[model samples]
Target: MRLAWKRWIFSLLAACTILSLHAEDEADLEQPDDVPWEEVKSTLPAYPEAGEWLPFFVTSATTNTFYIDAKSLEGTKDGVMHYTLKVVSENGAVNVTREGMRCSTREQKLYAIGDDRSKTWREPRNNQWVFFKKWAINRQLNVLYDDFFCPGRIIVYNVNDAIRALRSGVPVSGKSSRD
Candidate 1:
């Protein structure tokens, strides 16, 4: 009898919890959708100057930084935002520049490391595992930043995981963070 009563109580509690969560989701959905662009910009940190690197996202392989030399913002009639960011990197003696997008959708365009003619990336030592790591990082960032109501200025890689990964070292080029 006690076990049956306890089970009934547990089921009731679970149902109540689920209903509460559903109510909260409905409340959020019903809220006004007019997010002021100025307010959003105000929430973000100050833009990094030409020479400074801003923390875009990080991975086990590289602490990816955005040297946004220039940025242009535009808003579509449907309210989608577009950002054209000019990124410059100086790895060794080679100076490479590419135009990347930080936009409202997953249609991101990432350029090759070298110039248009060369189309090659001379990756540094201890950094061959960057592209895959970066792809995953950007994928998650898209899910977060693409949301119009997402209240986040930046996405950060877990510090503990980063330290562990660094200590363990790279495990071949295409290996993911989970591996």
Candidate 2:
């Protein structure tokens, strides 16, 4: 009798927890269809002027996901203005925290890296695995200075993993994530 009663209680508790989580998810998804663009325009930090090229962006790739999943940067707007960000998982498995940089030749088009071409980037600096993207730094500055021979950004994923994910196509890309 005790085992049966305990099982019933546990099941009931589990169901309640799941319902609560679902409710929270629904609440998070309340924004309009254009919310992504709105957030990008309003929340994105302004670039500090660089000399020749315009500094476009210097942030973690987690920016998009964090904006979508959490609706805010770590529950605060200030955290959004960062070159580094973290991802927290419910199970804590594939959590990510990395910084990225992207620079642009035009001030109005600084945010075109990854999603666009023509942006100037620095050669990937592989200093014992802690690489840096000069494009990102350029975006946050008032100059268009970079070492072209080393402008390959050290992407967040390894070559194999990147190939696999890229093969997964638009799903891995945020272009389809909003939907």
Top of the candidates by TM-score: 1
Over the stretch 1-179, how does candidate 2's per-residue lDDT look in tens digits? 99779768876775565456422132332223443422223323222122122112222222222211111111122111112222233354322222222211111122212111232332223312122222332222211112110012112222233223323432223232123
lDDT of each residue in 66-147, candidate 1, tens digit only: 3222232333333223232323343534344332233322233333233323543433334111211122434333322322
lDDT (0 to 1) per candidate: 0.31, 0.25
Candidate 1 residue runs with Cα over 4 Å from true position: 1-55, 69-71, 86-105, 109-179
Candidate 2 global TM-score: 0.17
**Scored by Cα lDDT, where does model 1 land?**
0.31
What's the CA RMSD for each of the models? 17.6, 20.6
Angstrom error at residue 100, model 1: 8.4
